[model samples]
Target chain A: MIIGEQKPLDEIQGLLEDAEKVLVVGCGTCVTVCFAGGSREAQILSSSLRMSSKLNGHPQDVSDVTVQRQCEWEYLDEIEKEVAEADIILSLACGIGVQAMAKHFPEKWVVPGLNTTFLGIPVEQGIWEERCAACGDCVLGLTGGICPIARCSKSLLNGPCGGSEDGHCEIDPDIPCAWQLIYDRLTAMGREDNLLELQPPKNWQVSRDGGPRKIIREDLRLISDELES
Target chain B: MSGKDNGYLVGSHLEKMLRAGHFAVTGELGPPQSADPAVIHEKAALLKGYVDAVNITDNQTAIVRMSSIGAGTLVLQDGLEPVIQMTCRDRNRLAIQADLLGAYALGLRNLLCLTGDHQIFGNHPTAKNVYDMDSLQMVQMVTDMRDKAIFQCGDEFKGQTAKFLVGAAAAPFADPTPFRPLRLAKKVKAGANFIQTQLIYDIEAFAAYMEKVRELGLHEKAYILAGVGPLKSPGMAKYMKKNVPGILVPDEVIDRMLEAGKEWAGKKAADLSPEEKKARSKAWQTEGIQVCIDLIKEIQKIEGVAGIHIMAIEWEKAVKPIVEGAGLYPRPEVN
Candidate 1:
């Protein structure tokens, strides 16, 4: 799950403070799972804004709608009619959803309701810890399923940093040393030999450091000549 | 002023009397999941004249609940004082400010600001958790609203200034590692007029907690409402023990409940049948109500404790009986 937290109520309200007609759009994907953008949260926010607008004596016409996946074009198409009516779009989705909304409706103002935090999972009921960095590479297979890119405060792939002590990160005692956890998991799996393999320095070029990435499959392409009449 | 003059007493006087050892009763009402006025009115009416004030829960447990403003409005319309429970889960500062304005407009006066339960605890586990501002910031937000009619985000309102009897929550037992009273004192400094604590079972420990609150001189600055809940069943006791954070369950209380069962008595200490165990669990649940009431009586005697917030949890009907059984009566004027 993409674990995200909602922006402060005051911050979100400030984003749409000047709007007369506010449309809150929710996404039903990673953000929804993280509790940031979902139908329920969207409605609660809409009602809150409406109530606040009333309280301020500057009543707003607040409407709420949820797209199956705000990051997808097809899902955003559903809100074209509603988007035209809104003075401001308060997206309760994550960063991707907000960008997608802005992409589809370039002329309309869009504000984010959530602070995109991290790709994580619920460790237990009511607790979510970051677990992935989406570093544009696959390295977990060599690290006992723990992503050093996400958990190692410094994203060190080779070994524990000097700050690790007593299997706890020096920066935060609450955080377990990611390398230690990886070592223990690997040791339990009888794959301790993998630790001896010195990892090459990460290639930042293949990841986000390179220009925006793209993929092309010639087999999936349609011929333009055949499309023309 | 005599109690007969005005039905609704300002929370300050009530807290003073409560700290002086007068028993106090409070109740909670979970808002429904919609904007319909009738449902909100119905629930508020059920609690009217029974509870000192009906708590309008704000997106409790991150579940989709009605806005506190609407529910508080309904309670006010019904001639009952509404304690608006504002959570930092949903709104940013702008929305919080806006709601405070709306709440004052609706004539709702009391406020309980909470750093809400995370989303994973609710039905929608994937929901985004918002803690941009914690409970202390929320208290400051409301106080700012009341003091300047300006939101944290600089939005100005030309209306009657809000005067909320602000409250916050603390768990003395949960974060035992920290200085809990010190943390609570910070909330008081942030403009918390009172505090409604997490559910407490151990009076002796709570009394000790009260002494700490007194040491900080918080007893002079803020009212403290000790939270209490009557376990409806043995299953509920187990659920509370496992699920509710910051709550402690004394083993002796559970053992006493188990001992009260008819099937358990005269049966050998060893070798109890499965059927006997199930029957005993049922009997224990039946005895839990009385146990909680007795606990409340003991809690009322604790110094520096202002009142009790009875969280019946969908059992609002039993509130009157529990309050009466605990040797408390609604102020005559309120009735």
Candidate 2:
């Protein structure tokens, strides 16, 4: 799941300096689970902004709304009235959702209130670890289900470079050496020989290196003829 | 090279020594961070006759320096052989291949493949890294470019390939110690002609690693050069033993270095005058070279050991004394 953190109140207030009316939008999917862009967070953030403005002698009109999925166009369409009434639509979703609001509304100025961190799941009560780089090509099978592209500091293919110590990465002790984990798992499975084979240079074309990516599936698309039918 | 038994790959001095069954002696020469060519020339002069060939490091420790090939060309101009080090951390495959062509064109004969230190450890921590490929992939690519006359993209070179005596670094005591030897095997399988390991202070551990390397007959596949370095001071020794991962400096070695500064063992840093501090530092340095020389002699006795890669970064002056003390002076002249 995508993870994000709310922007600081000072920065958000600075972004809204010239705005008269503001709508604090919240996302219900990934950000909600991460407790960052959920409805409760948006309402709390909206109240804080109102109190901060009233305390500063410049009272502001600030309200909030939550969408089931802010990334999709239909959910954004549901907030058409609120979006049209506001001077700035502050998105509490990931970068994708913030752009979706601007693109769908066209005239509305959309600002991101949350910094999307990474594609990962909550590891514990309040901890999260990155699990995928979304590099487009996955080699987890060869690595015993561990993703080196996301976990290894250098994304080494034949790794656990000299930097690894005590089964942890050289950069941060909190991070486990992905290659060490792979080596242990593969060795336990009696598939240690799998590591002997060399993985060729990764073709990054399918990844972000090829620029903003799009997947067009003709089978899933609805053309004008199909819509008419 | 007689052109019959497949003689030297690049005919480099190091390759010739290994081919002639003489224990080769290689050393390192780190380029300065500035654009001054005199730094390269001065350091190259220190290592010219002390080592068979000197490895010009490529931004070692993620610190920016003169380009390895650029420094290597200057080393060549100084009448010394140079083994250029290339790391995957800085360049993509295209830039690496292009650099290989340029390095060869400038008369370089040896190459060392590395994964490079992380940018976070360098002066430019904010720099974006380009680990487009790892060291293994680099070794395979460089070897193919030399032997098959093809680029990493599989396109034919159409003319002369950049033939080099390819080398790679091995960390014998890195985490997951069971896999270190196997990693060396993978590098050897990828066509690395020689192997230089991370610096050693624990002979037991390194010898054990060599046992595994020998068990796989990787010693025959590629020449193995054990990495060695002077300690500089007891603080540096203790710091490495405690802080530097993958380096194993024993307590005894640390004790020896401490004993060198026995005259000021309990003296406070604030109490010592500048000259007294310098005198103590000189004593520590003298002992450090002795320790390194002792290590070289022991490492040479290991069954699979073929040479030593002395790394005296920023202390190139120590190489002469250490080499001479180890009875490796008057390096063999192989044509």
Candidate 3:
């Protein structure tokens, strides 16, 4: 899931400075699961902003609404009235949601209240770890299901560098060395021969290096002319 | 494609030393943090005529320093062979290959490919690292440049290709110690002409690792130059034992360093005079070199060991003494 964290209250307040009306729009998906930009957080933030503004002699009217999914236009359509009424629309969602709101309401100012961090899963209660780099090409089959592109500190492909020690990375003792994990799994499976072969230089062009990626499934798209009347 | 073209890859003295069946002794020369040619010249002078070659480091430990290529030119001017280190943390493939061409044009024949220390460990913690290619792929890319005359992108260039006696580093005692030898085999298969390992403080562990390496017969594929460094003081030994991973420093070695300071043992700092302090430092250094010398002798006995790579980290003065003490002086001429 796309995890995110709320920005500091002071920074968020600063971004909304001098605005006469503010709308705190929250998302009900990934951000909600992370407890960052859910409806409750938006309501709490709205109350705090109102109190802080009143104390500073500029009490701006604040309001909030939660949408099912902020990334899609259909979900954002439900909050058109709220967005049109506010001078500033603060999005309490991941980066994608904030951009969607801005695109949907092109004339209004939209700012992100949360920072989208990574594509990861919570390994334990209240703990999240990144699991994928979203690199277009995946080599999980060869590497024992662990992603070196996301796990290794250096993302080393061939093997662990000199910095790996005690099954941990040199960057931080907390981060497990990706290659060591891959080695262990592969060895246990008697697939150690896979590692002996050199992994050629990664084709980064398939990744972000090829620039903003897009997928066009010709079969999935329906031309308007072909749609039934 | 392991130098089958013959006539030597770069004909570097270090390469010739290995090719000539001589026990090579390579030294390290750390570039200064500033652009000072004198520092390079001074360090190279200390190592000149004492070892087969001098390795120029590329901002080792993430600390910014004068470039290895720039410093290596000075070492070359001072009548020494330099194995300029190129790390992947700072440059992408284009930048690395470009630098290799330029370094080769400047008479540098040896190259040590590395997956540079992470930026978090260096002075610039906020800097982004560019591990565009790991050390293994780097070795293959460089060898391809020399043997196949193609760039990492598989694009053939139209000029004299950058030919180098490609080298890579090995860390013998890193975790999953059992897999370290297999990792070394990958380097050999990647076309590395020589392998300079990380500092080896625990010989028994390194010997066992070498036994695994020997079982695979990797020693016959590439020259394995064991890395050895003199512990500057007991504090250094303790710090390395605690902080640096993959470096195994036995208690006995640390005890030797501690024993060197026995003269001032149990004395309060307030009671010790400046002269006594100086004397203690000198005593520790002498022991450090002696211990390094002793390690070289023990490492020499290991069957598959080809030579030793002495990294007198920031202690150039110790190189000559360690080399002489190890009976590695007058590095055999390989003409």
The most accurate candidate by lDDT is 2
Per-candidate TM-score against the hidden true structure: 0.56, 0.97, 0.97
* Tens digit per residue, CA lDDT, model 2, B1-335: 22323566778788889998888889999999999999999998899899999999999999999999999999999999999999999999999999999999999999999999999999999999999999999999999987888999999997878988899999998988999999998999888999999999999889999999999999988999999999999999989887777999989999999899999999987899999999998999999999999999999889989999999999999999999999998998777
Q: What TM-score does chain A of each model score against the native chain A?
A: 0.91, 0.96, 0.95
Clash pairs of candidate 3? none
Give the C-alpha interface root-mean-square deviation per candidate.
Answer: 16.4, 0.7, 0.8
Q: Which tens-of-lDDT digit does each residue in B167-258 have in candidate 3?
A: 99999988778888988999988999899999999998888999999999999989999999998789899998888989989999999998
Q: Write the per-residue lDDT of candidate 1 for residues A83-184, one digit (tens) a residue.
A: 999999999988888999999999999999999888899888777899987768879999899888788755655445334445676446678878778877
Q: Where is model 2 chain B poorest over a 10-residue stretch in terms of lDDT? A: B1-10
Better of 2 and 3 by DockQ: 2
* TM (B chain), model 1: 0.84
Q: Write one digit per residue (lDDT tens) for candidate 1, span B1-335.
A: 11312322233333334444555567888887776788776766666766677787888877888787887777777877778898766775557877787777777778898866656557787765544465677787777676657766657756667767778888776532134676687678777877888888878788888988898899878778888887765556666665554677777666666566755666663667787767775676557767778888888788777778888767676677677777676643412
Q: Put down candidate 3 lDDT per residue, A6-47, tens digits, no spaces.
A: 999889989998999999999999999988999999999999
Model 3: how far residue A182 lies from native, Å: 1.3
> Which candidate leads the pack in DockQ?
2
1 against 3, candidate with superior DockQ: 3
lDDT values, one for every candidate: 0.74, 0.92, 0.91
